[model samples]
Every structure is written in structure tokens, then in C-alpha cells.
Target: MELKPLKGQHHVSAITANAKENYRFYTKVLGMRLVKKTVNQDDTSVYHLFYADERGNPGTDLTFFEIPNAGRTHKGTNSISTTSLRVPSDEALNYWVKRLEAEGVEHDGVSTESGRGSLAFRDFEGQRLMLVSDELNKGVEGGKPWEKSPVPEEYAIRGLGPVHLTVAKRENTEKILTDLMGYRRKGSYSTKIGEKQFDVNILETGEGGTGAEVHIIERPDLPIERPGRGSVHHVAYRVESEEELKKWVELLNELRIPSSGFVERYYFRSLYFREANGILFELATDGPGFEGDEDFDHLGEKLALPPYFENQRDQIEARLKPLETKE
Candidate 1:
């Protein structure tokens, strides 16, 4: 199997201390759609929550695992440092600036980066986030609006944008992403992080759109990151079909890389592996999506369990916290 390039980010999964609070923050504050409510396959005691675009598109999703006592994140190398979402334009970013301010959500002033205006901020759990304007996202609007969302349609987030990864050095990670994963180097941009200035190398999936780009931050001075709440657990790349997924699994084995055997994830099949930098990466199929359990109109309205867990729904629901639906 030849190593295949990723189409774009399928969805990023993080660990959250509280599922209820995480749900409210993403759905109400960010105005995203709650596309799925399920439990982690590895740990049935925890809830796996998915927040995505209105239509539940592949590249538009972000997921979280509910781990109540999970502690704060320690930032360092080999961790997904930032998650960026694409907005329509500079005006769209301006709208968020004001809305975030009115909501008392702390954020940074708009600044230009990689030829686009960007606004940086953090979530309630201290996860780094950024809203950026890019040509690819100019006319892309979220699929459908939650009628009660405080944010207007025009200012709603389009989808996932470039994700940033900080590594001890760029040489090895660059090879894995560019040489093996089929990413093309876009270019480099310089940015300052406090007293020191560093170069951010931009690479894209070559698919040319939202979630296609990845920014690498070289920071040899930093130490390895510890897994905890608010830190990204793994980043998944989208593959169109099972054939493509199989090729990726074979590629990983051929390369002598460790990976979770192809796992059936209900909505989509997936295989997880750790990259050279120790960042967990997954290859996920794009079909048989969120609508598998409930139709579009009723998506995320109730707890959704895989067929294997359907019989155990009662026990699962009893252990989980209640997630409210939009009125």
C-alpha cells in the first residue's frame, strides 16, 4: 500500500472536563450544530460529543470526550497547538470580534496572518482557537442554522480551517506530512510569540479549501506535551471510501508504524496511528455519516448508540449527563 495524502481534516477530537458545559459552549456560544451524541468505543462510561456544520459535513466537525476530572493542558511540542475555523471574510471576523466582546468572551484584536485577517482566542477550557478569513471560505456558509443561535447566519463559522502543530523541530515532521502524507508546502510566514519570533511553515492537503492547510510551529525549546483536558486527543484526515482507508492501513503497517487496527466507528470506519512527532493521527472514511441514526431534521435530538450498544442504551444513558436540545 502506498502512503496516501489526506483530503482534509475529518474531525478533531479533544477531551473535555464536562460534556454539558462543552456542549453549551460550542453550540450556544460558537453557534455550531450538535451533530451526534454517542459514547467512546474504548470507554463506555464517557460520552463522545460531536459539534459540526449544519449538514454535518466531513471537514466541519470537532468532537470531545467527556472526562469530568480531566485536568488542564500543558502546552509543548508534538501536540495540536491550535484549531482554526474559517469565516467568510474580514467583515465576518469583525462581526465575531464584536459578538465575542458582547458575550464577554476574551479574544485578541484582529491581525493579518498568511494573507488573511485573523482573530485568536481560547475556549472555556483553554483550548487555543482562531477565526481566519481565506479565499476558499469566502462564500461557504454553514449548511443550516439552529433557529435559536445568537449568531447571525452571515457571521457563523464556515468550517474547520488550518490546524497548527508545534514540534520540537520541523525536519522529521515535515518529511512525514510532505513526503509520506502527500501534503504540498504552501509557503512560510513569520510570527512573534512574546519575546521571540519563529517561522510558521504552511502546508496544505492539496485539496485547496477549509481544513486543508496545516501550520507547523518549530519550538525546540519546548518539552513534550502531556495529554489532558482541553488538549486535542487526535486529529483525523478524511478519506473518501473503504478502499482508500485500507490503503492507509496497509501503508502504516508497511512503514512499521503502530496503529489501531481498522476499527468500525459506526458512522465511519477509522484507523489511528501516532506520527513521527507523537501526535495521534487517524484516517477516517467520509460516508455513512451522522444521519445514520437520525435523519437530518432530528439529528442530535437524543442519545445515539451503535448497533452493538443499542441493547445497552438504558445502562449507558443512566451513566451519562443530560445534553439539552435546542428549543
Candidate 2:
């Protein structure tokens, strides 16, 4: 009777205003591999790209939907407020500080809490970032370090740390994540915004800190967010295989939650739905894998498409604006 529909956080997708700059930060600055380059299934003009460890392992992925010239998202509830990535240790954090400083990338100095160290920054679209020290992530098997990236190997981003988001109301969403999704509430913490104080809910993914922490804050003073550039598009959770995926779909259905049925991703099968808070949630299987479409070492060398779009490759590529080389 262990029905943990959420195996772990598979990936988090955000909206990026510029594909090139987004690529630069994720690949050159963050040292994450561009695991997949595909188009948005709904809007073919925009790219749905994924960056992750070399093999694009579930919990390690951070994805984006490139909206060429979209404006910034309004800050409020219903938005992914921050994303944390696990780094090796406190020493490694110094390396990142130096790296980001050298590149003129802006960041807030390291903040320590409960013996944990974190460095905060913002992406081009103003999405907040927190880099943390978590030794358990060192030497994690699949990802490659960008040799030229200023961030050192010892401090390289291991994967997603915990995706922090703000919500309007916590009832329905909390119920889904805790009761139906099986996430255990770790504890609560408070943070201040202006003169207002807000309590944050901490949920443990137990998949390790890489994709382990999920924090949701409720701010009544804040307005709802409109998805655009500078906003998170969706958050995906991992599943062991297709069979487990079916079980998850059944459980979600039993709870009267609507979901997108199983869709094949070449690398994994997926389903999606939105929690009441407005953040899109995706359920992706972990099998078949990045090796299914390309070689182990060259997974993202070229644009990849789902089988349904195979015949339209030429057209798709033609529509895409060329990406600059990253060294």
C-alpha cells in the first residue's frame, strides 16, 4: 500500500526570455549539460529544452521553455520563487563566488542557516537561485563539469536543490502533495517580505537534497502570477518505470484529480496536471532513457523530436533561430 506517486522531483521547467542567454547561464555558467533540445508540444515556435547531468537523470534536470521576447513575470503567489542547486561544500562555494564575480554575474554572498550554506543569485529573467553546500552530492555519477565554466568541479552544481514556490492558498495543493503524493512535512520556517511575515512549508522529497526540498510560501498581500518570462513553467516528479507511472495515474484519478494521460518522451513517459496553487506538475518515468535517441556521450548534439514530429524535423529546425556555440 505504499503509493508514493512522486518518486522524486524529475525536473523543473521555467520560462526564459532569450534562448541564447538562458543557454549560456545553464551551460557555461552553471555547467549543466544541454540534455535535450525539443520544441514545445503546444507551441512549436518556442523551444522546450532540458539541461541536466550527462545522462539527464530525473532528479538532476532543470528545463526551460524559451519564449523569445516575453516580458518578465509579475512576482506573486502561483509562481516558482526560487530554485536551489546543491554544491559540494563551503569551500566550493568560494569558488562559485569567485567564478560568478569574474564573469560579472551578480549574486548575494553566502548565507548560513542551521549549518547549511547557500549563495543566492538571479537569472536573466529574475528567477531567484540558491546554491547550497551538500556533500552527499559530490561525485554523483552521471553529470559532466564544464571544463571552462568558472564554477570548479568540487563546487559544480550537482542537480536541483529544492524548488521554492509561493502559493495563493495551501489547502488543495497541500492535500495533493502530502496525502495523495506522499510527501512528509519536514517542518516550517518563516521569512519576511517587506514588513509582512510569512510561514513556509517544508516538504521532504527524501531523494537527497539534490531534488529533495520543496518549500511553499503563502503571501496574502501578493497577487497571482501570470506565467511569462521569469516564471517557472512546470515541476516534474520522477517515477521508476511505466508500470509505476500507470499506478500513479490511477491514484491521481481516484483522488478526482484530472491529468494528462501517459505521453512518450523517447526517454521517458509523462503525465501532467496543475495543483490548485497554479504550478504545473508533471510525472515522468525514468526509463528507456537519454540513450534511446542518441549515444551516451552525445545526447544533445542535435535537435531531437518526439516520434510524432519526426517527419517535421527540417521544418522545425528551419523555424528555430540558430544557437551560438558554447565553449
Candidate 3:
């Protein structure tokens, strides 16, 4: 009867065409701290960047792949269309919208679609992001706030409150999220996009998105998505420890869900797989985090690699460009 293997949302990874722009937007513009800067193990040419709060907490972390030359991503059902972050209040949301607009970032007006207040906008690389007002979690404040941002110090982005994923069918995806992932349908809201009525499902969470919440959208009529430049790379679920992760792997196998072998990611072990509905998901353990190999205050300063890649640090560093481009 217990199908949900994951405790809650661990993190969300997306592809970025420009490392410099992406880094600046997440840290400088959005006021999140650059937790880690490393090379992608799969592709050393691109940089793997993690942004989170000052402490580099689990649910607050958002990872990105920086590929300067990746082609445009094709939108379809397989892709994750939008990632939502929870803020403190509507006043905070309004402040962020104005701040982004003042900086010429461009955003939709304040609106209420699903009993939740939100401000939506697109990132530099066409990634759709929304800031929803959820006052449940009291996120740690204090970071280099973007000078031009309207979001005040007391009411800033807590972390990923709820991530909205678009899937091909409602049944299979819903089963995985609620049954296998341990999420409950808090409620549903509808919005008019073009000529269609988009149904959005909100899942309840105690932690308010720190491995605590997730939302799924049933876009049945949309075509399949092709993974590439602009699409989401993967979504990772959080667990308390390696023991919990191992339990999940065993549970998945018992349920007949195939998975990639366990991979030691230094900070955490990872297991990868695709759900029936067609989205890449990862089971990530939170432990020795970004500070494992580097100092807490000075994360994301230089190229950091796992122990296996230590021997080839030179080659790896040479292959990738610095995320902070000097103007």
C-alpha cells in the first residue's frame, strides 16, 4: 500500500544555454547563493551549477546545466514546462513582479488562477518560472539581495515550494506523484490558456517544498517533448540518508520500475529513471553537501570535482569556461 518511495522534492535540474547569464540571474538577480560550481560528469564541457540559500539546504537548491551552444528545446509532453517557487505573501509576490519588471525582466501581471496567488515569467533562456505565495515555511533570510529587486529582506524566496510538471496522461503520472512519490492532492485550479482550460493540481506538503511539496499539470492534448537545450534535464527527490535511498531502490525494483545503478555523487548518491509518463527523475541523498569539499562561505568560487575526477582537474578546468564572465 505504500508506493511513494520519495520523502519529497529534492531538487530540480534544467539546462541553461548561457552559463554567465544563468549564474547572474539566479544569484545576482534572484538573490540565491551560488552553492556549488562544478563540471558535469557526463559532459565536462558544460558547467553544473547549484543555487540555494546560504546554508545550501536540500529543498532550496536548484541545479542547472550551462551549455552555451545547445540548440532550442522542443516543447512537448515529456518536458517540464514550469518550475514554481514559494514566497512569503502576496505583498512579497507583488514586490518581486515589480522588481523584475523594473529591471526589464518582463513578467505577467498579478493573477489568481488556482486559489493561489502567483506571478509568472520566463527566464533568459525561455524557462518558465512562477513565484507563488505560500506562507507555511519560514525560509532563512540574508544574502546579497539584488539591489534593484522589489522583494524585501523579510519576505524573499524560501525555496522550491512546489514544482509544476506537465505530463502526457493524467492517470499514470498522477499515480507516480501521489502513490509512488507520497504526495496528496491538496486541490485543483483551472486557468484559461489560449482556448484550453488548463487543470492544475496542487499537492499538500508540511515543509512547504523543501522535499515537502510537488504539483503536476495534466496536459493531455499537448504533443510529446524532445529533451535538449531549453527543456528540464531532470527532477530529483530527496531522502534523509543513504539507507532511505537504498530502501527506495529496493522498493522500486519490487514494484517493477527499472532504475539506473547507484551512483556516488560525493555529496549524495543518485539513482536515475524515467517514469511511465516520460519525465527524468532522480533519487538524490542529502548528506555531505556543497560544503563537503569546500568552505561554507566560499562555495562556487572555483571548479570543484568529485574525487574520481581529481586526477584530471587540469584537463577538466581547461575544458570548461568560468561561470562568472568578466565584463
TM-score of each: 0.94, 0.91, 0.89
> Which pairs in model 2 have colliding backbones?
54-143
Clashes of 2: 1
- Runs of candidate 2 exceeding 4 Å displacement: 1-5, 113-115, 136-150, 206-210, 324-327
- Which candidate would rank higher by TM-score, 2 or 3? 2
The runs of at least 3 residues in candidate 3 whose Cα sits more than 4 Å from the true structure, single-residue gaps closed, are 1-5, 136-152, 204-211, 325-327
lDDT of 1 by residue, 185-204 (tens): 88989998989889999888
Off by over 4 Å in 1: 1-4, 135-148
Residue 325, model 2: lDDT of: 42
Candidate 1 pairs with clashing backbones: none
Which residue pairs overlap in candidate 3's backbone?
4-180, 76-224, 76-225, 77-225
Q: Candidate 2 on 106-208: residue-level lDDT in tens?
A: 8988776324688888876787788877755422232455444455667787677777878878766777788767787877777666787678887765453
Provide the lDDT at 303 for model 3: 80
Q: Which prediction has more favorable TM-score, 1 or 2? A: 1
Ranking by TM-score: 1, 2, 3
lDDT of 2 at 36: 80
Better of 1 and 3 by TM-score: 1
Best by TM-score: 1
